[model samples]
Target: MGKRLAIAGVTGAVGQEFLQILDQRDFAFDSIKMLASKRSAGKKVTFKGKEYTIEELTEDSFGDVDIALFSCGGSRTKEFGPAAVKAGAVVVDNSSAYRMDPEVPLVVPEINAEAMKQHKGIIANPNCSTIIAIVPVWPLHKANPVKRMVVSTYQAASGAGMAAMRELEQQARQVLNGEEVTCDALKYQLAFNCYNHDSQTAPNGYNAEEMKMVNETRKIFDCPDIGISATCVRIPTLRAHCESINLEFESPITPDEVRELLSTAPGVTVMDDPENNRHPMPTDASGKDDVFVGRIRQDESVPDNCGINIWVAGDQIRKGAALNAVQIAEKLL
Candidate 1:
């Protein structure tokens, strides 16, 4: 028999993607439960030719579940994750709530599957950009330690949620139709425009999204002294996220070496063809599983060929969020 599984917040964007990915990968589950908010209860959802009624997620929801996948929100996770663990369910949370907690392991199956072996019932999926950034970086770090990293992200509206994605689509049509564009999911209009991530700004002048990258990287690598900085921006794209990264290694490294290393790296695909103007883009990455990497070149600022620049893109909803959470659940199996 397969493990009994439950997906909290099944009505949300990431929750829906979790179901899709589970089916796509044919993850075995003897029973699956769909859970949502009170408003979404009683809704019927079909999976694998059977319909399951969505239920309100209460403390009792995880009683018989062997594994629970959470993507509802941090507040819900804080309130109910312990309940799930108490009920003997291993939780794979996709929120930031427990990621920084020393007790919880922030895992990317491809990068740190072994971390899950130490979990005390809860495991965290890293932030989407952090996941996308680390998949390609970890391999190179293993080869040549990365001393410092600077990243700038072009995140899509979907990172905020499905509502944000719908808002962007509506705003774009309104802009072209000469009607007023309304904003709800995001602070500013996200149609045909871009802005810094709307997450609260810290006293350090970095937004919450930017700091997640800095802090999570150190924790995942177990290297507190590694220097890292990030600038996260919300671009007017529907899905997928792209990042420009500059890495300063402990020693000199070449673009060719980086390409060769990433080529064989699991969950990474190289699309560097500068002469033909080919490179990884959100359009090509949307709905894809692998993080697409390209635009490899030497950063001339650092001497001794110690710096290299690369661009990476991945489906914010897949490898970044839902798919990663499911992969963690797979490890438990």
Candidate 2:
């Protein structure tokens, strides 16, 4: 029998993407419940030629659900996740609510699907940037044992949600038409301008977004000692995120070897072609499932050839969030 699926936050960007991914992947579901906040209840959404009325999400919403794909914000998840679990549904949450909890499994299915066995009714999705950066890194790490990683993320407006994406589009037109730029969805102007992530700055000077990449990488890799430093910035792109990653391995690993390792890695697509200067870009990665990887080269700063640099891009809303959660739900079946 097919499982009963519930999509929480159905009106939001990631929520809508969840619906698209489920169809694209042909996920088996006997029934699907479209849930959202009270403000969005009763709205109609059509999926696979069937129309589903958005229902108000509450503690009672999960009684018949077998798997709940939660793209709701952290607060909503905190209020309702346990209720869903208590009602006999497994939650694959995209919020940060349960990510660092020692008992909850922080999963990237491509890297560690086995960890799902430890879930106490809920599986936490890693941060978008972390997901994008680590998909291609895991294969190399398994072969050479990455000792450290230095990452700089060029995130898209999609990370901040649909409002931010609309703001970017509006700002772009206003700028080109000589209208005053407005800043509401984001603290600063995001059209043709990049800025540090708007997440709160921690005492250590790293913002929450950067720290999420640092902390979540260690947790997902199951190596509490792995050294990771990240600098996160929001770029003007509408979707997909790009990262420049420098890796230092325990033993010498060449760029070619890294390429060979990632070539067959699940969820990775290598696009390195220096002759044509073709490489991974957000434009190519938007709405794509696989992370595009390229610009493979040796990092000259580190001696013994133990260091290498690569660039990657992936859709933040697809593989990074909705698709990842849905993939975890697939394992449950």
The lDDT of model 2 is 0.95
Q: All candidates' lDDT scores? A: 0.95, 0.95
Candidate 1's error at 5, in angstroms?
A: 0.1
The TM-score that candidate 2 achieves is 0.99
Q: Candidate 1: lDDT over CA atoms?
A: 0.95
> How far out, in Å, is residue 213 in model 2?
0.6
Q: How close is candidate 1 to the true structure, as a TM-score?
A: 0.99
Number of clashing pairs per prediction, in order: 0, 0
Residue-level lDDT tens digits of model 2 in 1-333: 799999999988999999999998899999999999999999999999999999999999999999999989999999999999999999999999999999999999999999999899999999899999999999999999999999999999999999999999999999999999999887899998999999999999999999999889899999999999999999999889999999999999898999999999999999999999999999999999999999999998988999999999999999989999989999999
The positional error of residue 235 in candidate 2, measured at the CA in angstroms, is 0.7
- TM-score of each model, in listed order: 0.99, 0.99
Q: Which pairs of residues have clashing backbones in candidate 2?
A: none
